[model samples]
Target: MKAIVTPGPRPVTDPSALLDIDAPEPVLGPRDLLVEIRAVGLNPIDFKVRRIREPGETAPDILGYDAAGVVTAVGPEVILFKAGDEVFHAGQINRPGSNAERQAVDERIVGPKPRTLNFAQAAALPLTSLTAWELLFDRMRADPDEEETLLVVGGAGGVGSALIQIARAKTRLRIVATASRPETREWCLDLGAHAVIDHSGPLDEALTAAGERAPKYIASLTQTPRHFEALVRAVAPQGVIGMIDDLPPGPFDSLKSKSVGLALESMFTRSGQGTPDMIRQHEILAEVAALVDAGRIRTTLTEVLGPMSAATLREGHRRLESGTTIGKLALTGF
Candidate 1:
């Protein structure tokens, strides 16, 4: 299999940061599907893993999560899919990932690809969509009938883009998103945010200036540490804040006074821990696909940086690390 692999932790500038190699095929498990990867999406997790996780000495580390592909074969215990089924998923974080021409992914987490989208577009949805859906509906338990305000931080990024659209499609919340740049602000509004504020300013003040009430729900998609105090001040009393980033300890004390609830959402949790409800991801993706087909939600793909290769993936990582990406980046073909 032709694949892209990381040697170990290295800056993207180093020539050895990512390597193109002909790797051995992945071994399939009982519930696994052997997929022929057609398109792969890039997220911050891709770069973060490449930088931090050391590869095993025996096998290369393949770093990718979002992928759309066709099942070439299925393990004996796999009941959800068979040969020739088109699928999309953010595979388990603990496994070798989708950066290769072929990958082995558990069938329980895979969903049928949206028929209305191309492989590149479908690939962009899985990871971001799952993260946003789980954070808003599963973790926060937001009410669809409530007209309360929901604020989204970093609204131009991949997860934020999906979050805004899904919220608009499924809930009645007054969506307010934070975006500093003109382009990013417009992007959020285009995706259905009722208001856009600049995150460069104090969040509490930004909400005030934008005429938005203290948000009953806040999805802190990035830089949770930097925005911790402001978010604490900005949230409505007894409201909930859902987070996906890694935060340093000790911020819990501040939320106590306001009676604010904190919920941490990690889309990989179920698969990583072998949870009983791991199949929920498959259901979520199926619902998302239906929404996509109904034109209620759309793919957040911003760019397709040529085919899958070490050089292309390196450039993708460089752009994501720049912290200015306005949506998702994808690469199709091998």
Candidate 2:
């Protein structure tokens, strides 16, 4: 099959950061489903993995995490889906990704595509949705009936967009999202955020100005280290705070006063560490798919660059790094 592969680690500016070349199509394991990809979404992982995975290490590496496609065939042990099924998935980070004409995915981590969404739109959701879903339910332990509120930092990105909608529809939590620009603020509101505050100032003041009595749960998506002190103040006593990014400096002194619990939300942890709930990704995506099909959740796709190629993939990487994009960016078809 024709696909894009990373021959070796290279700078994004390097012509060889990604290469469009012919590679052997992947064969599926008994627990896997081979999908003919129609649309693929770009995530931060696409760029981060470039320097981490070396070429000619057992097999060449491909980079893309979220995909929407059709099931062309399923392995012998597969039963949940069959040929011609429409699927979408935020695939595992430990394997070859969906940046090609065909991808082999574990059925356990794949989900049914929202009936209302096209391939591109569906492609934009999985990774972010998975992260947001796990962050709210598994980490924060938010209750649907509780009136506690959640304050999200960096609210216009992919996971932030998904987080706002889920918190709004699934829980009574008054959701307030922090965005620095007028467009982003409007985007967050449109995505179901009850209030949108500027992330540029002191978070405590920002939340207060947004009519928040006190945010009892907070999800910090970016700049977690810099916002650590502010997050401690903005959250209520005994509140919970979750972060998804890499390590940042922290004494967590502020949390000490409130008896707060801090958790890190890494979507790939289950797969990376071989956790007992390794199959939970499949379960979560299935439910998320049902919610999307029922119109409770919508696709976060905002940019469709059309088709896949090294040049196009590079541009998608460029747009993500530029940090001006709202929601998600997808490339459709081969």
Candidate 3:
């Protein structure tokens, strides 16, 4: 199999940060599916992991998470899917990922690809969709009938794009998204945000100027530390804030004054820890696919950079690091 592997932790600017190499076929587990990958999606986690995590001495570390593919084979205990089933998934963080020509993923976390979308489109959904879905529904426990406001920061990014659409389709919360640039703001509105505010300024003022109230739920999708204080001030009393980004220890006591609740959402936690409810990811993806097929949701894929190669992936990482991309970036074929 041809796989793109990071030799060690290095910046994306480093020419050797990622390399294209031939690797052996992946071995399967009792509840795994061997997928022949057709396309892959890039996320901030790819570059973050590249900069911090070192590859194991015995095997290379594959860096992709979101992928769409066909099942080539299934493990003995696998019942969710069979050979030739078209599927998509965000493979576990602890496993070899979808940067390769083929990958072994747990069937409990995989879902049928949306029939309305192609491989590249389906690949762009898994990781971001799971993150958004879990953050809004599972972690925050948003009520479908509640009319309270939900503010989303970094509204044009991968997870933000999905968050806006899913919230609009599944809940009644007034969606307020933050985007600094005109194009990004338009993108958020197009995705079903009730209002869009600039994140470059103080978020509380932005929300006020946009005619939105103190949000009952705040999703700080990026640069949490920089926005932490403003978020603490902007949320409603006893409101909840959900975050997925890694943040340094800060003045959490600030939130105490408002009696605000904090929730951390990590899409990898279930599969990473082999949690009892790991199958929830599969159910979430299944619902997302249904939404897509029913025209209630759409893929966030913005551009296809090219085939899966080290140079292409490095360029994708560089673009993500630039922090200006409107939606998800994807690559098709090996």
Off by over 4 Å in 1: 248-251
Q: What is the lDDT of residue 140 in candidate 1?
A: 96
lDDT (tens digit, per residue) of candidate 1 on 264-327: 9999999999999999999999999999999999999989999999999999999999998989
Ten-residue region with minimum lDDT total, candidate 1:
53-62
Would you give me the overall lDDT of model 1? 0.94
lDDT of 3 by residue, 213-291 (tens): 9999999999888888888889999999899996737758888889999999999999999999999999999999999
Indicate the worst ten consecutive residues by lDDT in candidate 3.
52-61
Candidate 3 accuracy as TM-score: 0.98
Would you estimate the TM-scores of all the predictions?
A: 0.98, 0.96, 0.98
lDDT of each: 0.94, 0.86, 0.93
- Per-residue lDDT value at 107 in model 3: 95
| Of candidates 3 and 2, the better by lDDT | 3
